[model samples]
Target chain A: MKPILRIGSGAGFSGDRLEPAVALAEHGALDYLVLECLAERTIALAQLRRVADPAAGFDPLLVRRLRPLLPFIKARGLRLVTNMGAANPLAAARRVVELARELGTPVRVAAVTGDEVLELLDPAQPTLETGQPLAHYPQLVSANAYLGVEALLPALASDAQVIISGRVADPSLFLAPVVHHFGWSLDDHERLGQGTVMGHLLECAGQLTGGYYADPGVKDVPGLAWLGFPWADVDAEGGMELGKIPASGGIISLATVKEQLLYEVTDPAAYVTPDVVADFCGVRLRATGPDRVRVEGGRGSPRSSTLKVSVGYRAGFVGEGEMSYGGHNCVARGRLAGEIVRERLAGEFAQLQVDLLGVSSLHGEERGAQSRPYEVRLRVAGRAEDAARAARVGEEVEALYTNGPAGGGGARKSVVEQVGIVSCLLPRDRVRTGVEMFGP
Target chain B: MKHKLFHLAHSRAGDKGDTSILSLIAYRPEDYPRLCAQVSAQAVKALLAGLVQGEVRRFELPDLEALLFVCEHALATGVTTSLRLDAHGKSLSSALLEMEIEMDRDIDTRIPTHAHAHTPTQGS
Candidate 1:
């Protein structure tokens, strides 16, 4: 076993930049580089793409992200682990193999499957929201369970240079390498939890290194545009020392670490993952030097017998239109423009939200007091039964440029189908995850 | 003086389903107690008022000098369907941090909240 394991973060979400991740592999000197490019709805949407074309269903930005890092990872002998496969791991693996061939590099990739639990879902499976039976929904686009590290053990055991997964837990991707590097058992909850903590911190890439942490004077971070990706050095005992790419601008203070530590986490004492139920409350974090923090004192309990599944179904469609109104009384004109669209789509729309950009947009009426600016953008969005009706919300908003409000211009409209998600818990015995390696 | 929670502490907001959890961590180790006492779930609920449709649950992590608050139904719907700009409620931390809290003594305003000299301690 290696004395120290260094894992670097690539992209936080699917659309995250490729620059920071490239910096981490080229400069950070990583043993393993992970990109967590999947979210709850992202895969469901990807599944929709797969329905249209068999080869589709993976992350749209996967090729661009992998292309830049492949040359570096290949030269340095760095391993790439990611959940960018989204809905189709095999197809994604095939695409990656093609990309490697074009780059004239030899690479090994692992494509794991069986996160989809749709086959096992029954009428009895109740959703967490209304606790309604799964059968109640006639249309379900996708249902994938959050798998654990065990599913990745085979891939890590092989000589795979890249490990790809569909919908495993974000932390599990990073934790898998730590387990393989240190030879940690699946039941080693304490050390697993420590490794899991490190995974959670780096899972969001630039978020930990001040991309999402900056607030100008309040929380100033230099070179946020070139914000470096973060990585953690894990010792045999599971002690994690966190830092970012060299010469990359961003701070790694106790505050930045603490924010990331608690990001997307519900309970500090029971941050549940498939590998372990980590307790972040007990985790200790301290600054070691500039752009570095020593993180330890992580603890955990056994994981739950059941794994959570994110199920996506057809909700409806969303239609939106926006028009910018400038000069005197812009807010009033914007509000008036919204009223015009509302009146036009009256009975057709199930729900409508009117927002005046300069004064009160996100909060709507709840944003009681308003600010009067010379320019205001009027945005109107609605829910409709079909895409055609949803598209009308945008049509009526565009019509306002000529008919409804004075000094109105820059009309933009779009109609998009909404993807709704419901969550359920499935027993461990029900899932059958397996991994296979592919190379060119 | 009425000081904003943003002035004395740092927070991170996250969403699960329709719930949004905000973890509030104090700048100084000694300031944790006041935050625990003052920044209650009720206060957060009151601060966000109409935005939160359900109950607010708070968990104190004295070990990290932090209090994590889970605000249910804060997102109009899950992010996939939410029409708001801040779909995941990423800005909710700033909204909660904007809350006014009464303080008796003046904190050294020179040091930023994310700045170091942080004394690490362990207690639950």
Candidate 2:
């Protein structure tokens, strides 16, 4: 009714940091602040944290940031939403409510649950990539379904002003408020499509607005003190404008927008979600100027039967070791050492996938096996059964010091086992989005 | 006629093992309850043979004054990697429009027009 205003809000530069987030919200330029704190590994970390200190888990630092900014959010009548509750939204909400009461701000907090499928994990669900039942490994660390904006609608409608969620789809935070306040239905396919595209753009905050853009020459876009969070203005006609805190740092350009559009969405036309099958290709990106890109003309259809689920598993143990090279044959020397390790692994084991990072020449390509580099670190990944051999692989890399390359003396670094076989399972049942409205 | 045809599409599109659903038709705001009822009737568990968990989402598009029920989790059937209907599959909208209401052809054509008539002449 109020010309549906939406924005993308996130922390900048800091990894899972929330101090900056609270500072941004304190500025009061956004209607809804969506924080993305979930990464493949962060979820795993949260899972581990919850095990030891249930209350200590989650990125509480962001909640601390929100504590100082709650007064401003309530004063400005802005609402906040975030997935900082990577493992526990309820516990996270309890802490927020406590903080709110402490500050004398009667802000209500709602926790959207039923996303964590870990409870229902059949240990039996089949992996989409591998036909094996997820239950094959019982020690599954973490399993969650990416909930859409629908799940946040009820809490948002309660006029809580601040909504905390766990494992929500990264883009849903940006789109949920728009859909709820504007009273948009799931079938408003086109508008939902447009809104989703906008969410995808803002989900990463500065990532698109020049935070990680491909532009090599562009520098400093001002207002760096308070980085911008993403938001949008949607109308009755299904039109949306993607903008952020006007005074925030960073630049939004066609290149940035295009790169963000392709970030996780592989297919432009068949961008699938529980709500709708969005058409990202139909989006027309125009550089209206410096930090502004106008997106329009996107389309969407009713979603097909299946929800595209993101399943993360401990596929296998992964380890990497780096060795430096020098002299005229620096490049050749690195390759020779890598070859020696590969040759040893091949002779000893089977199906060892090795990758040379930092030194790949064709690193620019999204999916490629060949690359040229001065120094190469061999990376290997396989089943836990290969852990012994993998550890041997590491030993072999260190052994290369005696058998291969010029700088083999000090170059031989011990192999560090970074990742292990993780059992990940997705339950058949998950919580669908529900709405709860409050007010006269 | 539209509902019957959509039901057929829903049956064909429903897969096994994967949680997914087929939306035979998009609904309007006024049609939300109806859509909800229809989705509720098509229990996600029933369609997946009680092996998978699923739900039906009624996507409301106030802009177009339309609603669509997305049968999510129908992919529980693990029918396919992609749930999008093949281009050759009958278009839901066209099928609804082309359906001959043997009982009221002329009246059916007037449905959309009458719905539009209820819209306010001025913006709220």
Candidate 3:
């Protein structure tokens, strides 16, 4: 891996641009291709999908596209690693296997689990803050721990071409391939730190590139469409080179890289993870080139005693409804309707307990006060039944189209009633993360 | 509220080493004078470079912004640093928040050792 071949991960696309990601994989001849699509709301969407169809798993967009690319990856013999298996890796594996067989590619597939800790949850257990066990909240829905990539090592070690995991920490998805291939030990703090950093940058894909950064210069790079995915050629020792595929859209400029660097950091000295406490204080970022940003100089120390667990429990119910109003009084009238809806709900179903997420409201703007052209969205959350009732609230506003202020036609659809689950993270010591891996 | 915290409690837990992605956001750049009176990047860098006893060898972040920094670490220190409002004084608190705080880790550093070559290579 001399001169270390590497590329930026997907440039902020949610694996939907599989064509470009695969193209990048082929062109870059990458040793590893990591696809990350999980986020906070993503978990909720996954749960909803599971509810719709237990066998259905992941977003299915990657596997669907990968079917065509499997031949290329198989011919090039590149490894694929991703956390696309939202809640069920095994099921996702089955889907991948089916897709591969259909494509007539004998690709080895592996699934990693153990992140879901819902089965270990006891209703009688109290909240870490409140002594009362979680049983009090009957709304407890989904609970999962942030599974590290330690378990995926064996699968990758087996030389599996495709490794699918459930709820893997986004950064770990990228780090696992490097660790497994390089055979890095469990305690190499510096190397793991490097892997983790790489994963973080790759996890967001293009966001670290020019997608989020508002660069003044360098326009007409190409279609933002068909963006390239990121890859890394990591050696055992922990040094890395940051690069991306050729002809990829967007520039990895200094401003772009800097914007991503400031994505989610609290302090420079105590940057912590389940694996290590990285010191960001001594780090440096310089634009190596158009799509290349160089990173060097970082410090690390031992981790704390336990890994913090991210557990999701059923919080309450929420319903979101939207209506589009065209014309001059759009923003103002929309807000007025929102206030009316809330007042009506409070007056009628105060006990129903609905919280209105003033749709697109600003930091301190008074409701219905802003005068701007806008679409209005109203969100209400409470008990399950309350959320259902809130969905009906949209109808009342629809009825107002004929009699209400600014009597003009408006359209409302996709009245959604959903429950919110809150993950009260516990220490890893308190949760279980054990899963059995089956192989040939 | 609905976030997955990659809590790097400890950095030296494996042979693979540790890393992180950090982001920094600066609330105000004009407060540099007051902020310099309070905290310095050099001080933070020194703290990171300090010879801490642990398995984590080094850490880094690739990019940084005005008041924000995103980074990955080799080892994680669970403890958090608190800037007491009273310690900085109320007059400085506003400026402190407005001050562009540097965050984000994206580099890999090695602990100084007597046996290594110019730059550490693959094998131990």
Candidate 4:
């Protein structure tokens, strides 16, 4: 058995920096590079794009991201895995093949599909968020099950150099290669759980390497401008050490690791992904050296019988308008502009939110005893059923310049069709997964 | 002595549906108990009364000297549906750090005096 397997995270999210990933591929000496690009609402929005154009559902940055790394994977024989195939994996796979051919680098690509289960969804099935039936949402756009390591293992087993998927669990993207390389059984929940700990730690790429951390005077992280992505050296037993390229910038201390360990995690004892119920409660981290931390003591139990499905539906439009007021009683002027908009559009929309950006936008309306600010931005936003109704909200806010509040400059307005996402649990057997191969 | 939670701890916020998950870790392990005592679920809910409309649950990880808070109905109504400018509630962590806590005593002498000094490398 291999003493240690090296896996590097390329991109944490859809819009993460491309250079860090290229740096990993060129310098990290990694056996596998996993780019976890899909967010909870990404696939639903991708589904909307697919409706507009059949071949446009994949991540927009897929080709731009792959263009730089194709040479390293082709030369070093390194494998690549990603959920960049947000709504369509086959098309993404085809695009990769075309890019490889253009670069004169021959490679095999695999597309993992069957996450989409819109047809199988029953209107009567209750959702997890509101406990309301699926029928309650008439404009349902998409339903996708979160696939696990099992879905990607077949592609890994194949000769495919690149594996593209849609809506796979984020951590599962890293865990699949570990399972395949070690020939670990899917039923081995303990090792799967330990492997999951490594996956969770590395999935956010730069986050593990101190990108999101750094509070100048408080928790200081140096060289963030050129922050390096992270990689894990995993052993057969699933113990690992997380580190970054030595020449790269960033810190890998207990603070960064501990903060990321519980990120988005509601329960450390039970972090449920598709493969296993990973127990991070007892996990330990030790700073072995500069830019390196050893992680161990993670355990797991049997996998859950149900898989989480993200349901996306059309939730109407959000109309927003912003205008600035400055110099002398700006707070009062901003509030007056907000009140005028609220009174003009009162009872017209389902919900209207007005706030003075400099003072009361983020926390809430209750501002207790604060000094007057020289400038404040008046922002008015409302949710409406149609685009025209939403546009009216911006029009009223813009009218504040001449009609109501003085010095209402730099006015900006936008109308966006919102896609709302909710979750539901479906039996694992209900969702079928498959893989397709493409080559130049 | 009065101290802002920001001086004692640092936090990061994340979102799932309409729920916001914030992890608060003490800068020093010795301060963990103080956070456990003062940063109760009730205290957190009351502090974030404007954003959080549901129950607040806190989970402790004594080993890491950290506290994880799960606030339901906190993201307005999830990221995509929420009309707030900060739909993901990413700034809520800073908001939570604004809480005031009455310290049991003055600063300890053992604490590093060069806390703000940015060393080039933490280790060789």
Q: What DockQ does each candidate score versus the true complex, computed on alpha carbons?
A: 0.52, 0.02, 0.06, 0.45
| Backbone clashes in model 4, listed as residue pairs | none
Q: Going through the candidates in order, what is the number of backbone clashes in each?
A: 0, 50, 98, 0
The sequence of per-residue lDDT tens digits that candidate 4 reaches over residues A71-123 is 99967769999999999999999999999999999789999999999998889
What tens-digit string does per-residue lDDT give for candidate 1 at A1-440? 67999999988999888888888888888999999999889999999999999999999998999998889876887999999999999999888988988999868889999999888888687899769988777689999999989999899889888889999999999999999888999889999889889889988888888878777666788888778889999998898888886698887778788888888887878989899999887787777777878888888999999999999998889888989988887778788888878887887876788888766665446543546678888888888768998898899988886799788899999988988899999999999998877775
Residue-wise C-alpha lDDT for candidate 2, range A248-296, written one tens digit per residue? 6665644345445655442456776656778876566554444545677
Q: Highest lDDT: which candidate?
A: 4
> Which digits, one per residue and each the tens of the lDDT, describe model 3 over residues B29-67?
232233333334443333333212222212233223233
For residue A417, what is the lDDT in candidate 1? Answer: 93
Best by TM-score: 4
B97-122, model 2: which lDDT tens digit per residue? Answer: 22221221122221232123223321
Error at B46, model 4, angstroms: 1.1
lDDT of each: 0.85, 0.53, 0.50, 0.89
How far off is each candidate at the interface, as Cα RMSD in Å? 2.9, 17.5, 16.0, 5.0
Residue A395 displacement in candidate 4 (angstroms)? 1.0
Native interface contact recovery, all models: 0.52, 0.00, 0.09, 0.52
Q: Which sections of candidate 3 miss by over 4 Å?
A: A1-8, A11-16, A44-54, A122-133, A215-222, A232-236, A315-317, A321-336, A349-360, A366-387, A424-440, B1-65, B69-124
How are the candidates ranked when ordered by TM-score, highest leading?
Answer: 4, 1, 3, 2
Place model 4 in a CAPRI quality band: acceptable
Chain A TM per candidate, in order of listing: 0.97, 0.79, 0.83, 0.98
